[model samples]
Target chain A: MSGHSTYEPKTGFERWLDTRLPIIRFMNDTALDFPTPKNLNYWWTFGGILALMLGIQIVTGIVLAMHYVPHVDYAFNSVERIRRDVNYGWLIQFMHANGASMFFLAVYVHIFRNLYYGSYKAPREVLWILGCVIYLLMIITAFMGYVLPWGQMSFHGAVVITNLIGALPVVGKSITTWLWGGFAVDDPTLNRFFSLHYLMPFVIAGVVILHIWALHVPGNNNPKGVDVKSKADTVPFHPYYTVKDGFAICVFLLMYATFVFYMPDVLGDAINYVKANPLVTPQHIVPEWYLLPFYAILRAVPNKLMGVILMFAAIAVLFILPWLDTSKVRSMRYRPTARLYLGIFFLACLVLGFCGANPPDQPILGHEPSGFMLLDADINSIVWLSRIGALYYFAYFLLVMPILGLTETPLPVPEGISEPVLSHPAAAPTGAAAAPEKRG
Target chain B: MSKMLRKGLALAALGLALIGGQAMAASEADEPRAPSGGWNFDGPFGKFDMAQLQRGYKVYREVCSACHAMDLMYFRNLGQKGGPFYDPKYPNPNDNPYVKSLAKDIQVKDIDNDTGDPVQRPATPADKFPAPFPNEPAARASNGGALPPDLSVISKAREGGPSYIYSLVGLGFNAPVPAGLTVPAGKYFNPYFVGDVSSAWHGKGPAPKGGFISMPPPLAPGKVTFDDKTPSTVQQQAKDVAAFLAWAAEPKQEERKAFGLGAMIYLFLLTVIVYFSYRRIWRNVSH
Candidate 1:
């Protein structure tokens, strides 16, 4: 479901294949000649960066699986062997472990970029929803992958998170028992987690194919956040974007390599190094950094069931984000008032992440003198702060968007992608050399 | 996209409120902040100091080893390629004379070759370090109901990190209880733990800054003698053991960093060239 292909086979064998299957033509059309928005900026490069990271993870993971033991008794020791005994096994293991963090880092930026530009609006809702689906899959896949290590954090993390599913009312207990394959997290649990962790990335890859397919249908959303009026607004996707994306990918990899090679353990929980024990519980169990925001949401509310609901709802709200943000204007850049709230929302998320990593009831501020009591509930400042953050998180998506979208005044619109390019002298060189060539 | 759809989505989200109830009181205390200084293996170029690790091993053997188990490490591990006692003359720990002697110092029970009965014998290079206690229950029972954690990965396991261990062993005992601080009966007041609660207070009260830890004062000045004639000051011993534990947690860290430095150079150069090629291609077009 792309635009008509302009490709014609040049040789006899190529012609025969083209007529028979057209697979080569599909790649040629999409990669070489597909029209893409020229105004797209460095933010759009994250899609390519993400694709690179996924490929890195898959390759490293395949090699690691060659040596990783998924059995509960052997899993922790096997990882140690990889670190100490295996060839450049250290590099491969570090790359895979740190790769998970890099993947999440890119995905977060990509998701937020879409939000800022209103890329999820209108015809792109299906694409956005598919992205959200991939995100959910990634989370599940990462969680399962974490468990396969079978260390203290891995085992206990599996116990704590899997137990959250038991908060469901009627069938929850049965589902939990069924999931564990017995009464509690045991050998069977580790085995299943390993199997699913390996399988989920492929499912994610499948959905990614659809996400890109959907993008090709409507083409890309640009910084302008407006539909392309003509071919003038677009250029062939290959040389232009490929070169830019390639450069961005390299820069991204440079950062990732620094982490993988030097500070491999920085992003990991220190407790995960200890082998799993059923009898002892860590003082505080934290999920990986990527899951912290939602973890904060879960802990914000006191009720177990309600906390679960809110945590799930935080993600659920993202699915309907397109409908919630009713603004006629697509980009938040042009909506001054909306920008303010979005900035606050960003900090709120960071604070939530910080709180999630720390003890909930730990005093955020200095301890007071002897008998200071204003509100008994306010004793734990950090927990109360997280609650406020959670409140704003929900209200931003469900409340603020609907009210602001219809009310805010958007700046004057550009007639086409070239409007600003042509008006500004510094950018005019590009418009003069480039826009007409595509527009023709 | 439509009014009904919007309402439906909102209602679904809004319905989350119906499940709202009170939160469980947070049962956590502030974790100790890791004391920061440059570690030998801190940067991209850092490597483990072999001599320091040897000293650390002495401290572990003399003090911490009584209660803690380092299950993953064998006596031979100390003489392996990246380990502290590793000698270039004998790269394989199994071939190292020092490791052989160390292994033979401990006895392990194994099935007898002829009689098929469990028998005790001196450990060889291949044997794992014997635990001080046979099982978890025995270990717990001997240690005032607190199981001294396994040391093989303790430097990597605890939140405040190996540096925190250094702080605890070297400086933790020096911290006096604040004027208002009142530690409970069973807990020892150490700055590195969750915090010592007051004897009269329930668990819900605000945790003091200097937290509760189970281990009594273990390391002290002149506690362990160093074979290399390094003075066994508490600070020196603490740092050495911390260094050794870091090595135990990930012995290949030195090699990893060395390779990283080279890889970083190659990648930075390759990426720079790729960046230039990107610019060259983009010169004809603009975005």
Candidate 2:
């Protein structure tokens, strides 16, 4: 023990770190060292999996940048060259492209994991807020990166998004001009977007570091919502979690690799293959899969500026999730009412994503199509779904969380650590009883 | 218990045999075919004839370097000689030398000279193919308003590779008008011009049934010698050059296929490992 203590650094960089960044040490002691509830199922592994995905994206993205050209004229062709010519360029490009989808997949799971566990509660509020911020950044980065290819969709997307700024009251035109770097979305726009897309990932990496830091502050919230009381409740993260996370990462990679190699462009838009043509517009302009919910929300509002603002607010509201839920319990396993509503809310989000990806439908509320007819029926459907999704998206935060917090939660108190673990068969009855208790 | 274990082992072996048999069958089915000399102009064509492609590569190396730059392509990729696809083993030994020679030949601007005037001898491989013109005005003056686009992504940028090149080169005179417009004395146009049709062309005389293109057909009728001793014609040379351009545009074809195959194998192995590992870990535990 004495010898082990002596191994600790006494001076220089270690000493400096000890003083300035006590948070890491503190985290290691309190949250990491703090015993975790033993009943955390596979769902809890998603957060670790999500972090691994972020790492994959960053690594693959860096390698892709080595071969990718940023020029509008050459960007799409360069991508083709990478697919066709560069040594193992196809693998790198496919990995990056498919990795985007995988990252979203993991994030969706991670978010759902948080919802299921109520990990957004109390002291972990900052962690949850940081996660929301990271999600928004991810959306922005993906969107901007999509435009770098200068494909038909990319051009239209830029036009649509930049034009959204023109919907503002006073300095709209100036702002649009400033954003475009010209009167229209042209070469300068592509160049600047390329620069920013490259830069934003680094920013996201920094934020992720912060997000993980915040997570470590509270450690992990377990399924039971019961705080750990002793050493018996927890295990060291090095071997146990290291192995678990590693296995999860490997499994995730296998799935990712399958898609990357076999069906790389499954998630991509076909229109993106065609070069950007300002004169001839594509039949459809869909945002990436990740942005579907927000895209739906953007269409939900009638007013342009208001819709944009609402869309921004929808994401911004997620940052305040820590404060919104007044629930004493951390995990939805104990909070039965929160569980059901959260599940429904999750389903609603999925529906919104699906609808957003689909072509918008004509609004049933109106008698005739608008005179302008610039906006399509698909936009209308997206708007309605957006409105509903946005409403639900907010309701889950503002109304549902607070309401569920006040309501009674049907919970089963677990026996001591040595009690026989309940298998799925044994847990069935408990699950059945827990059904009606899902109030939110 | 021992008998039961042996039975389980036998079953596992049988499953492995089945899988192995299937994979063998698949591999046999996917074998690549040697290039055929039949040059079909219509429908899909194999990327290009490998022999003609190699000759075209040589031509590009020797002659085209004087005026044109394939900035999009790498030197070593030409060695994907067996097919239109690239092979990593065939490294371009001339890459460094070619680049150095090019650099020595041309004078790119340093901070001292921002205008970027070429300094001395002609450009070497290291130098960016010196622009035909220093600026937009110079380029227009030299190329008759049409800037020679970078050859790097040209194969991808254009719709059909060989036919486009062939048509672009085979310009001479205009065909008889379809009763619409009064014809000029010397000017000619191609009805099948897929690209900006309005763009002007420059050929010496009346073209074949198709409209005359501005670019005078560069091939001297029977220039490129084919490997199978196929008729060495202008059309053949055009096909060869187009194939070379296509290969240059996308050199990773073979590597992608190889990696894709490898990844599938790895995934199959991974799946098996994970399945066994999961079974091992959960063997004694009751569900």
Candidate 3:
């Protein structure tokens, strides 16, 4: 993709800057004239969508920080004041709040697209690892941002998550105390969280630059999962991808705006509207929807330490996925058996999220007091359901990725991108025999 | 298809079946689900009815305000765009005479500038809605340890919003208390309230539908007279106040929806244009 620079400095000022910086030439090589696989699909557009979401969150967040108060007493009221008094503050705040959910949605799609195409394999492992780092930062950033409002859920969610660290052996309690800046999640905690919340997005942005730079090295992996072999198999990224990504981005924005305007708080917990009270805890405390799968994994095991370890392991496992997968072929499109396992893996993650939202004792199968016990807990309960989901979640990586990849027979892959694109019936008029020439 | 894929699909189908079955079989054992129906502001196109908001305000002022506080609200909010008393001619809500007059009726605690002493003053349009108590401790003390939540965003603060408010206040009291259910001294039974009533229920088929709520049934027939001459039944008052709470929760809702329409149209056109351009640019490349 970065074979040779094609940009020329036509103007006097451009030539001067080209000699000094050559940033114009860099942008041209990476973003404009970079040779990308022509067969990339809508799934590829999520990269651009995620970039747009990060920008939206940062810009809106900076504006929110201008008026937001970090003190526990004033934080709740200040947020309300922004909504009630400041001009278009409601719009800005809602966009920022809902933008977090939207950001996660796009990132999940992008991650899944990578998995399906084996984009994490071989030369692209560093690119995938950089993405994982960004994701971890995003989770921390979103968690801290939720605490800034000093709502009931915000306070309790912080307490619950921070306490998970205390499950460790010796230094756990000390670490928790240090993190809180006191004995519990209090004013000091809120102040530090607000400061870090403002800082984390910029950190995520820095990592994102590395992620993109790593991406440019190997370019994009298309749906075909085949490497671009010749000039005919590729197209200039500028007009080819820019317009397609722009179209997809507009459609995504339409959905985002619908949520921002019509049902801004649908994704948010209603309990969050209540101001934080140290004495009283909410009956049921759940993390934001995006983190539910991990939360479910945390609660699935009965042992506290083991559950914490397992939850962290779930994400840690993804970092080593490139090594776990042993398939010679990259794309699931050519691997029928692996595709099924991946589909089940997808469903398992969704089930875990569903279970996470519910209480551990609540039934997901038989009625309550049914006397159906599976080990220590009821077989009917959400804990059992989550355990099953978590089991499959772990197995998908450790078992399916390692075992199925070696055994499954992949469908024969095309030699080049143009072979399948030209041979496909949709590419030409119905009556045509041989593939037609590329349009001028 | 491979044997493994078939087995995976079978497992997925079985799991889906169990989930679907549970979803249909799950009973409302904790509290009755709040019924949401016939509200003017129900959907994407829904807008607050101004007259209904005015009536709702009367109910809030007369009833709920005695215990609850709307600390986030200001007198100017009532006269802002999409508010009950909004006037297009008066763009600035602070300049709206109706809002000013309404604010003047309430006495707010303040400090005397020169004397350095506490004083009571007539509230201005800019003033926040006065709380019923001086502080949370006092409020809880007065209400028998049950703190009345702020009503500024009550509609968005609860699970079902306006519907939950209406049900808990208006219809909850109508349900007959199950035999052997012990109501707490200060708490009244409301079927729409969420709680574990198993301890209090000694003689029930499965403990009743609801739990003990601190607030007694607040709305009554003819509790507050509407200025618009609408009938002042308990149901009507509850509905009106709920609508008012919804508007108070997000005064800019109508404005948001209105803006969303223009945004949707613009995005739709932009998408269409971009889509066409994308097609044209990639026309030569089959993939």
Candidate 4:
């Protein structure tokens, strides 16, 4: 956590304003003078990358909304018109569409980094939960945003996902009907989705403020996962992190621009170019790639009701992850056994994503009819692979986290952030230079 | 009206017509992968071959226009920047004599201001390319229940862009119906069309690699005599039209890539500078 304000008013106007609101001081304390851990690595850059992505999505989305016709009948053409007719509209539209993917990419990295460093433990629980809330809102926003295009995939994806609510026992059908604003996903549904799609980002922005506030209170979690013991363990955030994050962001933008300029539609499905037809459905109905892992989990359970429950539960489990992880050691860097499980957990998630992108009947290892039959599907099928993936996904959290934490023999942890920096091999060769220096 | 507002209104009208002209049926999947057409517009720095686009336009005007529509395109677009008929001397597409003449050749449906009755008028460069069928039902009826889709974004709407179009028209349509499969009364066999041929397949272990398309092969060798004196083989015709459609799908693609080159270079430089700045700033800290 940051110490007392080091800001001193330098001008007459500043002195007056500081007495009136202290807003400048607040900004300085939170953004510039904040004491960030000195050992934070490139993984920490994702937080800054995520913030930039959100801003990009919001700004581009607003421009798109200006040219966009929200009605289902017009949505597809409106988008095409933007790409074909509007000035630099192609750039804006591509950025917004691909921005959703980029946003998720950054968030996923941020989450995984949190898991590896145990950033969610103890004082950072509230920060992590707020992040989960923002992530949840992002899913809802991205889903609705996709529907605004009214492409074949957009319409059918909405229909399939909305119908999941209908799997409930009693009020399921009514809830779904209410959600759709009719008996089916139609013009009214598109209207409401547009409204919410436009609204959710600001809501996310608000939660993001909370997320940042919570983060600033606990400060940053370093790779070493040790508390900052003194002033020597930290650095001013501005020139150090801002410059690093800026460099990382520019590199990120290079990848983003490549997709935007050269292969704009590669991340998108060709089927979506077809206008949405309620009378017919696409051969494969898949959600966007970011949400694929959850979709895989949902379909992994054969029972519709159970599938829906499991899908929701997967995200819900993240909300309680801080408590579920029983390891006393914060970073996997210290707990070698726990680190292995985390690696497998990450792999399971990717397998789930692969499964989600494909049809369940499709074979993973070989051609269909692999001469081995499992429950309701071939043993080699994506469905079976997804089931195994889903099981590991849940077990990694529920069983592995708790059990491994209590049993794993952790490597000796450093006493403070400075100790790791001082002892590192790179620093050992330059002991005098690496030694912590006292600040005035 | 101000020029900006008029342009905006025209674009809005074109957008509306495009939505109104949307085709209902899904273009079935391709079984055989479409080989690369090796189009001029194939890569990051690729530019459209002006002669090919002009030839492609001739094919569209003479052949595809009979059954298909390109509701999103304006005649002026033909002479706009990067268009098939674009002339560097003519900054305004409307003033391009060739584009103007092409527009005047087509009779578009309109209303007479004086008589208040529907009339046919020679189109201006600003006019949208007229629809082949007035409505979807009529198109379906004429095509035996399969409506030919609007070609404005056909290259983009389908997978593989120009290559897919080239393959479907030139190569796939001519493929022999495998021994077991029966071509239905109206439908033609297309090896590139994506569909399950299982129901129609009576003789195979796996169903043959394509699906039935309502439209018969529309191109033949020398279908349209080229203005550029290029050979008029069926393959050449297919490739040209595909290129034209790709250009039509996103006329501003060249502009996008040009702008991206600068953006990529700028970002690369900024990243390097910032990276060094980070290094210089962190040099003494040694964390």
Model 3 lDDT tens row, A302-383 = 6667888999899999899999988867777777778888899999999999988876656776565346665665677776
Task: Write the residue-wise lDDT of candidate 3 on B57-162 in tens digits.
Answer: 9899889999999988889999999999999999999999999998999999999999989999999988989999999899999988899989998898888888
Candidate 4 local lDDT, B148-179, one digit each (tens): 99898888787778888888998887777789
Give the alpha carbon lDDT tens digit for every residue of B101-180 in model 2: 43454554433365566445544332344444456566546645544555654554544444454445432222244443
Q: Between candidates 1 and 2, name the one with more favorable lDDT.
A: 1
**Model 2: residues with Cα > 4 Å off, grouped in runs:** A1-37, A335-337, A362-387, A413-440, B1-82, B85-253, B264-287
lDDT of each model, Cα atoms only? 0.79, 0.60, 0.84, 0.84
Clashing pairs in model 3? none
Q: Which digits, one per residue and each the tens of the lDDT, describe model 2 over residues A291-357?
A: 8887767655555677778778888887888777777666676666777788889888887787566
lDDT tens per residue, model 1, A145-251: 99988888898878878877887899888999999999999999988988888898899999999999999999898888777878777878888889888878878
Better of 3 and 4 by DockQ: 3
TM-score of chain A of 3: 0.95
Global lDDT for candidate 4?
A: 0.84
> What are the runs in model 4 whose C-alpha is more than 4 Å off?
A421-440, B1-37
| Model 1 lDDT tens row, B208-285 | 545667788888888998989998888788888888898988888888888888888887887788788877876765
DockQ of every candidate? 0.29, 0.07, 0.32, 0.25
Candidates sorted by TM-score, best first: 4, 3, 1, 2
The Cα RMSD across the true interface for model 2 is 23.8
User: How much is the lDDT of residue A25 in candidate 3?
Assistant: 93
TM-score of each: 0.87, 0.62, 0.92, 0.93
Tell me how far candidate 3 lies from the true structure as C-alpha RMSD in angstroms.
Answer: 6.9
